[model samples]
Every structure is written in C-alpha cells, then in structure tokens.
Target: MTNFKITLYTDPVCAWCFIGHRTLDQAITLYQRTYPGGRHDMFEFIYHPFYLRNTKPEEGRMTLEDAMLAKNGTEAKVLAIKTKMQRIGTAHGILFNYDSKVGSTKLAHVLIQQAGRHRGAEVQKEMVGAMYSMHFEQGGNINNLDELVAVAVKVGVSEQDAHAWLRDDQVGAEVDELARTAREELGVTSVPTIEIGGLRLEGAEDVGGIMEALVSVKEKEIAVGGAQDPF
Candidate 1:
C-alpha cells in the first residue's frame, strides 16, 4: 500500500481553519469509502502551526468581534465577514461564535505539539477539534494557560503535563519559530493550508474541491507506479 502524508497548517482561532478541519474529515471519510481496504491506514495527518493575528501575550485578550472590526475598519464589513464565515461553518456542522476572545495562539500551538509528541496523531487531532470548538463554539479563551490546559486534559493529556508544556518558554519559542518557518519556508500565507500527495489546497476548500484534489493526486500517484512524487 502507498502512503499519503497530509500536512495541515492552521491556527486554532481561525474560523476558516475550523471549517477546513471538518471538511477535510468529511473528505477523508468519503475517500476511504471510495477506496476501502487498507486505505484508512494509508493516510497520515500532521498539523502545523500558523498564526493569523500573532498577538503578543502582553497585549492580552480582545473580543473576536472587536479584532475583526479593527482590522476590517467598519462594523458592517465585520458583520458581513462574520455572517459569511458563520454560514460556511454551519454548512460544515460547525457553530461559530464571533464573540469569542482572541489572543496569542502560541501556547495553544505548543499544547498541540506536545499532544502529538505524547499521544500521537489521532489524539492530536482530537485536541485540535476540541480547541476549535472551545474557541469558536464555546467562546473559550485559548490564550489562557488554564483554559488551554483544561481542554488538553479533556483530550487525554495530563493536566500537569499540559501546564508544564504551556509554561515552558522553549516550547513557546519553538512554536513561534515553526509558525514563522511555515510562512517563510513553506510559503503558507494563510491559515488552513493543506498539503497532500504534493498537491496544495489553500484556504478552506469545500468538500467537493478537496475530494477532487485527492482523487487527482491518487490517480497521478498510481500512474507513476508510486515511483516519483505526483505534483
């Protein structure tokens, strides 16, 4: 069996990233059903860090709505963007809370890194999904160490370990560097950038688009007899 590595660069607080996460899951389910028998084990998912706001810890937390208004320069524009995001999220079974708090995602990314190191990819994915739900649906402040740790614990991470990892300056710095490398080296200019089988899908593509990309990649890989990378 051939293996396909799927790398997702995302920020926890991004609404589109949340939507993309769910959409990718749906697409993977459909792909597995279409090509069953060991196909499920043929895919490996890895999550990387990307910062949309990159707010400093000292800057503290602000309401997501306030941040958007500041960036978009008008209440109407912010409302329109929120409406669009909410509509898209709802279509993917995600309930977005525009009123949630926004702050530095450094600690959150560190938590995910630690989760992946300790628990593996599936558990790491669970931690990611929980973080998205906390930030988007429950209005939780992921920037807060306690809040992040709480979510981690719920996803099989020990509270002590979560607290230690988040409080580690080295881990936080590593996460920051990774986000920067993703932008500079990986050419990831936006959140929810997905890479699979050498094909890159930018932003939150719909399920159909993602599925098509997957199929195209699979076909190309097969055509090449899995001897070379399929772009």
Candidate 2:
C-alpha cells in the first residue's frame, strides 16, 4: 500500500514538463529529509506518454525554432523567451536549454511506454530524465532513432532490448493507444499534466502546493483507515 500515487503525462521535448519533474523531484527530496524514515517508498511516481504532436500523424512535426518563431514572430522575441525560460529554470535550480531541434516525439513516447512496462517506474524516470537532458542539454535530436537508442542504452536498458522493443509494432501501438486515451478520456491538452491524490494538476504547478496536497490526502486516507489501500 503506497501513501500516494502520481501519474504524470508528459512529452520528451517539453520544457515545462521537465520543470514539473524537477519541482516534484526537489519536493520529494525535501520531504525525505524532513521525515528521514524511508518514507519515499510510500509514494509512487508514474510517467505516461503524452505525445503533443500525435493529433496529426501524417503532418510533419514542427521544429522548436519554427514553433518559437511562429509564436513570437521574430527571432528577437524568441530569444527573449528563451532567456526568460533560462532565468526561471535557474531560479529553481533547473536547466532549460533551447538548443535542440525539437521534432516529432512519437517514437520517444513509444520507448518511454516500453520502459515503463519492462523496467518499472524508477527506470522509466531515468529514461525520461535522460531523454530530456539529451534534447534540452546536449541538443540531441530525440526523434532520431539512433540517438534514442543511445539514450535507452545509456539508461541501462540494453541496446539489444531497446532495438527489439522499437521493432515491435504492438509496443508502438500500445503507446499510441495510451496517448489517445489520455487525450480523449483525460482531456489532457498539455504537458506535465499530473494526477496526484485524485487531483489533476496542469503545467508547472508550485512544488510546495503539490506537497501540501499530498500531505492532506495522506492524512485523510489515514484518518479513514484507507491507508492500506493502494493509491
């Protein structure tokens, strides 16, 4: 029986999703330090595939630069947003590198879903962080199969296993189905949409607020003698 469960819907190339992850990561660290009783295991963090570009599979994906340019209408405005993102990330001890050529994340989502199936949540988290860092920090093309395979291998998912998973059409189908369900059923139109303690939080929500919500939920569950139930 876990104290709580958090289901995070995200995409690999999404900057805000990465920030949300960092925020929760920091909060968990703080919570552990304050409790110091291995209470971290009482919570489960699960990642789900949310392909932002899945609506139109046939239409080609947009590059990060193109998307930014479309929104800002000028390179100068785009650069300003980039600088603002860096400042915001730095204030929270997080990094937001805008150097990667962001393209389709369909394949990356497939790999993440596969990782969750075979390697479990911790490994999936590692894969998520690796993919995010590869794209956001090292400017790697996450859409590239070779680069994705490299990231999979780097995260302890064997190269052979990753190749096999990628080659499996059923696995890819499962990932697509999950993404579809998220959009059609959960109404998740954005990245970093987290369902925690029966509440769905969108975007980069405050860490302190999330922690407070978790604590409140846990207390209620305990009071109701439902702490033994799986969250």
Candidate 3:
C-alpha cells in the first residue's frame, strides 16, 4: 500500500497541456483497467493551476499562426503539435480545435481557485477541462467572463459566486496566490508540468512510460517501508 500524489500543473490555453491532460487520463484509465481498484489508495492526482499568459484578456489575443510565429515555431512544428493534440484529445473523447485563438487564462484560473474553495477540488478539475475544451475544441475565448462563469456553473460552482469570482474580482487574490505558487514557489517556468510522488513529470509521456513510472514509485515505497518497519 503506497500513497502517491500527482500534481498536474497546467494552463487553460496551452495546447500541449491539453494533450498532457488527455495523455494522463488515458494512462490512468489504462492503469485502472489493468488494476481494477486493486490499488485504490495507491495514487491521488490533483490539479494545480498554472497561468501561461498573465496578460490582460484583450492583450493576449492572437491567432494560432500568429502565436506560432511568435514562438519561432515552423509550419512543420505547428502541424506536428496540431496532429498530436487532436490525436490525444480524440483518444479521450475530447474534441480539440487547434486552429482557434485563445487569450489570457487569468480569469479562468480565478474561477478554479474559487471552485476549489467553495465546491470541491473536482469542480476545479472540471473547470480546467471546460476551459481547455472551449479553447481547443470550440475555439471559444476563455478570457470572457461569460465563458468562465459557464464552466464554473457546469462544474457546480455557484453562478452568483462565479460572477463574483469573475466580475467582482473576488477571486483575483487567490488567483495571484496560485500563480505565485506555480511560478515562484514551485519554480515552474512552463506549462504542462506534472509531478508524481514529489518527482517532476514534465512534457508528454506515453501511457506505458507513465504506468511504468507509477508502478516503479509504488514498488520503491513498499521496499522502503519494508526496510524501515520493525515489530
């Protein structure tokens, strides 16, 4: 019986972060199917907010091609990422349109912090997925307060509370705190950084690789406990 904490660090508007989400979901689903509740208490996955663009919603607006050009990404790189995101998203039944434009995710993360406080952690998770869907799947602007509130309500966060969090600036402080944790505290310089058992799992990893890492961590914990226990 080993306990593992996996922190998923991501931003709402990131393409690869969306891919990482689908990858993690697939890996976890496959792990569950393979284990079938046998390791119920083995691992706990938590979503942590990371803001890729801290700009104002209006200032962050850019088309997909424009963003790629800014990042020095070539057409081949763009197409490769597009294909990868679409493939991974489809595997999880998540629709993602990479051609769309998305703005700053500060408001989205503000809703997430509020969801974690009022509703529950899972609500925050749903909100994250919804933001990703809106940007990557529907090409909707996640920076809009309306979209933020919509996702918040869908995730069980109170609508009135959602409006407060979005329009009234109630959750701005909390969003700042999380952003600080993601940036200064945790030393996260990029989006889509995953941590498992206090170990960082960044970028995209295949299902087999992720599963192997999980199992390896579990085995190490068991071995260490067996060595330390005395009775």
CA RMSD, predictions in order: 3.1, 3.3, 3.7
How many pairs of residues in model 1 come into backbone collision? Answer: 0
Please give the clash total of every predicted structure, in order.
0, 0, 1
Residue-wise C-alpha lDDT for candidate 2, range 1-231, written one tens digit per residue? 345688999988788887887888877776655533426446677778888753343333455667789767999998888887798788777665555767777888888878888999889889888888888777677677888899999989888999887778897787788888999998999988988888887887777877776666766766888655322
User: Candidate 3: deviation at residue 148, Å?
Assistant: 1.1
How does residue 167 of candidate 2 score in lDDT?
A: 78
Ranking by TM-score: 1, 2, 3
Q: Per-residue lDDT of 1-231 in model 3, one digit per residue for the tens?
A: 455678888887787787777777777777656743433544555767777765776754676656766676688877776676667767767776555676777777777666767677666667777777777777677777776777777777777888887764646766677778889988998868888776687786777777776666666766777322112
Judged by TM-score relative to the true structure, which candidate is superior, 1 or 3?
Answer: 1
Specify the highest-lDDT model's number. Answer: 1
**Candidate 2 vs candidate 3: which has greater lDDT?**
2
RMSD over all Cα atoms, model 3: 3.7
- Candidate 2 off by > 4 Å: 35-41, 54-63, 228-231
